[model samples]
Target chain A: MSENIKNWLLFILTVAVVILLSYLANSIINRKAESQFAYTPQIEIGAHEPRNVVWGKNFPRQYESFMRTRDTSFATYLNGSKLRDALGEDPRLVVLWAGYGFSKDYNQPRGHAYAIEDIHNTLRTGGPTGPGTGPMPSTCWTCKSPDVPRTMAEKGIGEFYKGKWADKGSEVVNPIGCADCHNPETMSLQISRPALVEAYENMGKDIKDATHQEMRSLVCAQCHVEYYFDKNIAGQEGVPYLTFPWKYGTTVEDMEKYYDQMEFADWTHPLSKAPMLKAQHPGYELFTTGVHSQRGVSCADCHMPYQSEGGQKFTDHHIRSPLDNVANSCQVCHREESGALINDVFQRQKKIKQTQLSLEELLIRAHIEAQKAWQLGATEAQMKSILMDIRHAQWRWDYSVASHGGTFHSPVEASRIVSTATEIAQEARVKLARLLGQLGFSGEVAYPDISTKAKAQAFIGLDMDKLNDEKETFLKDLVPVWKKEAAEREAQMPIRPVSSRE
Target chain B: MRFSSLKKKLLPPPQWRRPVIILLGIGAGLAIYIAHIANVGSYLTDDPTACVNCHVMTPQFITWRHSSHREVATCNDCHVPQDNFIKKYFFKAKDGLYHSTIFTLRKEPQAIVMHEAGQEAVQSNCIRCHISQVTDPRTAAGVSNHAENRLDRTCWSCHRNVPHGRERSLSSVGFHLEPLPVATRKGSFVPAWLDAQVNHTSN
Candidate 1:
């Protein structure tokens, strides 16, 4: 117990403890590594196997997790796995999409597992009386099933898109699944849809050059982005070739330019009589302009965060809204509390929706005003500029709102798009007012009573009862036959078993 | 100010260089000795023992010990590439360097995670081992499985909870570099909203 001797003894004890702890750490990590490497090939998996059950036999952990996408319990403010009646919630949509099939019925997208079922149930596809009776083209099934790629491979891509929607009902049975975003050979993320590859090629960027992190979002871009069918691409004539109008860029203005160059219109607006552009869900396109994407955050970062079960880690396959799993999705990068993050999303969506609804109302009024101008013997020359204004304004509006999660994905961009749309719509209304005055109708044009979906449908001249009756017949008669045929075909495909070591 | 001037004046002479050199050499030698004892380089191999060199890997080790694959394979069997020696060891070296650096800096997360590369390796390994059971006969007849032709399917995307059971509860046990702040630790997930936003009709 000299003071110097005691200090030396303390230093020695500290060193000894550090060495012991290091040894203990090594022991623990070694043991864990042993457990993780243990594998017994329980089942043999084949190349390009579409059936999930076969893959599940060997990778039961991953398969079981993937199967959880079937659960529809989770929901967020704007979008989730829940099957929401989007058209029912906002009757203005019925008027906005007056001539489009979406006006009949549109539902919020649900989990990947329900892709096939939801498409079948939706009225947009219509009730078919026979193989080619459905209103939709075969191109409609592009994003809904893995069977699409399978069928395209068996029959050529052009041939696949040649028939009607129900023509290949028996062929396309499996819902969006494993084969849609991963390669069976390497199990690496790959873009399955040709449209996405071709879109990238148009932008002079090869998808093959995409980094691993970029592939995460690109795989989702395969189905989530806005697309259209073009029957004019050389050698693919008369086949509704799936194409993304992203040659210029992903911005609303950029896509508008692309469409304008082609003199393309999805349909002439029923009331406005303008060449209208229909904006499909442009999730990936708008998302690319968002803060998250700009900061290099991939869709999978939020929607498919890694989850641990029994010490094994894998990406959560239940892809849905980031808001549904704020802790793993947003909070992993954002330190804000769950309530705060959810509130942030809601606040953005609420504000965007306010402007969205106002723009919708204005467009509705503009369309009606144009119709009134026509009735009053307004010349085509007088109405041409007004119609173009209506088209551009509504296109901007639809572009912002149709992105589904654009508000949360990129609040500033969504706000700017809506603002531009609102200004254009007001200008169109003002022009409409002047035209009405010139035509000798000085008084205000009365707005149609479209307070409800049914009222809106009626105002737009849609016979909902007739549409529903036909849909019912299709579902009851043709649907069962399609399902039965699909089941029988799948049943005929045998699953080979693996021999277990004794 | 006087204390600082006095300290400067009391500093070692410019000619006394041998002691300084010896001290610096000893310091560098000790650092190397410590790193060696830690087995930092061992992680760059197809050895399960290398993974358990870190204390944080205890939960994974315990689970795998009791897993169905315990008797048949080891960690490198699924988590690393088997294509060629160079590629496999290269990945192992990259991963090992990253893990060592993070742990040394005390920057490891509470739970371990597998990145995209690790996921691909595990997925490919799954298909590689169980090739016979999952392949469809139609593929040989020129009807390719959509996954085979494109990058769209992985065995784990569906059979996630197999090999091991529930992971969240299992991973939450045993490993920690330091006690986590109670506020940030995993708790019963409470919703920010009582009903989903999808259920609401915006005004």
Candidate 2:
């Protein structure tokens, strides 16, 4: 070959090789990008698709891992996915929450998988055959199911919360799942509960503008946080509107101030005649004050870390206590030994428990003292301030204790809340003693004999037999119909297996 | 002049230099690859004997030794899954590559987060062996499976607080002191030394 021809041929050959290598690299990169975003609609996911198995066909990894919430073996010091009967374990709770539905039956929360089953089994829902008749309002099912969003979408949000708990039993069959916190089209974490969005609007904040990192914990916050059904909300009256008291703030004092200003009380205390307030679980709120949260650690960071399977990674949706997986949870943030980290949790828990027990005793005594004052013909005017103190005090106490995992989860904040409650309760008792003296009785009123759970239940006048009978009747008559209807409806839905191209 | 002559001889002509350099480079790469495959690098799995490795798992190892689950299980038994042959193998390979890379780069995170999926994998294995076995319907077990009543709660549902049953009971063989005391240097070795002394004295 001529020298010039040889040079030109070599140049052409080099350019061809370069082009081939670049094309190969680009193809590999594109395939990888495709793998991450390779979602194809294998089965039609309806708007009301509540069954996770159906969703699993389209998103196998998330679905398979979400099913793991059914595993109940994992236990921690204070919280886990396992079923624990709080009343059976500590019956003092029954008396403390006398004249309330929770006193009838209360259990430590299990995984989200059992939300529907646990609610069905609970005695609080009571027996009802007709609309607007059950013991619990339709708002009770708001946090328990993905069916909630579907119903809220079908019926207007206000209309959905307008009926009784049993009115929509069949309609709300699916437990909390992917739909509750995820948008099917995007698979992005989205708030499905209207209550959360409305609460944000009330505070002049837009939840849509939340950061991606915030969404990790915000998904669980949809259900786990405290809320109350406001019956007197203007223009929304009689709707039993689910509202968060975050207008003022989320702190115990802030919520108490808001309730006090509105002269709101959950119920007149059966024993003390004090205006009482019930504190729902404030897990997310208390969690935010912890060192972990301050360091930008989210609920999902510890509770739902990422897992790898078949060379692909996805978020694990088995949300529960982190202690069960310390290596994955705390060890990721703190280099402490697993045993040492567990001990850290236990130590905080034990110290807080000591004060919490003390606060409970003091509050119990305060209730009895207030009752004695009322018994002595103390005027309502005279008891008003004491009642308010009792109200605020017990609210604080309940806020700390009822916020499951609060002590170990946020020990410092939990301790402060309990201490403040103890102070207010002690002040209430002091006023009660003076009121009793003015009524011509001075010595300490003999405390009720509530050493055991049975004694406490009797003390509180809870007809357990009658309650259990009603529950049995409801389960026998109503639950079966709900389940049958749900099964019939689900069976009619479409489910298609993956097509074989081979 | 001698040095210049030596440099010229070592350098070789331009054409010869390229071939020589390429051949030497390929030979060096093959030798290193063989060495790596043969595990000839000073890679230390046990850092106690090889201080240069500085194993990052001492705390975990100690905690595992003291754990109640330690006797019945190992670290891998609870943390790794036994399902999906492909996935299991992938996990081992990925973890191996990751550890190797991190060791090479010296940039591993101080604390590793074990994913919820990993814990679930462990949990499945736990439930597999510990399935409920009480066949009799009459007994009032912690979790009874009464066919007549249709009340069949799982074993862990009620017995959730019983994992450290032996430690709580304290009557078992391996009951250590509560709120474990810091081991003194003398205290730790006293048992070993006493055993040796007793053997020597007896001999």
Please name the candidate that would achieve the greatest lDDT relative to the true structure.
Answer: 1
What's the CA error at residue B146 for candidate 2, in Å?
A: 66
What DockQ does every candidate get? 0.03, 0.01
Model 2 lDDT on a 0 to 1 scale: 0.69
The segments of candidate 2 whose C-alpha lies over 4 angstroms from its true place after superposition are: A1-41, A496-502, B1-203
Candidate 2 lDDT over B1-203, as tens digits, reads: 99999998668588778876875676566556544532434332312112112233333333343333543665555545567667765665565556545544546455543455654665566665553544433454544435533233334345542232221211111111111112211222111211221111000
The window of 10 residues in a row where model 1 chain A has the poorest summed lDDT is A32-41
Q: What does candidate 1's lDDT look like per residue over A1-502, in tens digits? A: 8979986996698668666656645644564454433332345444455677666676566577678788887777777877888888899999989999989999888788788888888889988887887898989988988677667666667778888998988788787877777555334555666777778768776566676567778888988888788878777778788888988988999888898898888999988799998988898988998989998888988888866655555577777777777777888678988999899889999999898999999999999899999999999899998998889998889888888888988899999999998999999999989989999998877888888888988988998888889888988898889889988888877666545323
- The digit string of per-residue lDDT tens for model 1 on B98-191 reads 8766765657776567888998998788877877656655564566555564247666667765455456332443322112111122211111
Ten residues in sequence with the least summed lDDT for candidate 1 chain B: B194-203
- Candidate 1, residue B40: Cα displacement in angstroms equals 19
Give Cα distance to truth, residue B85, candidate 2, Å. 47
Clashes of each: 43, 1
RMSD to the hidden true structure, all candidates: 20.1, 20.2
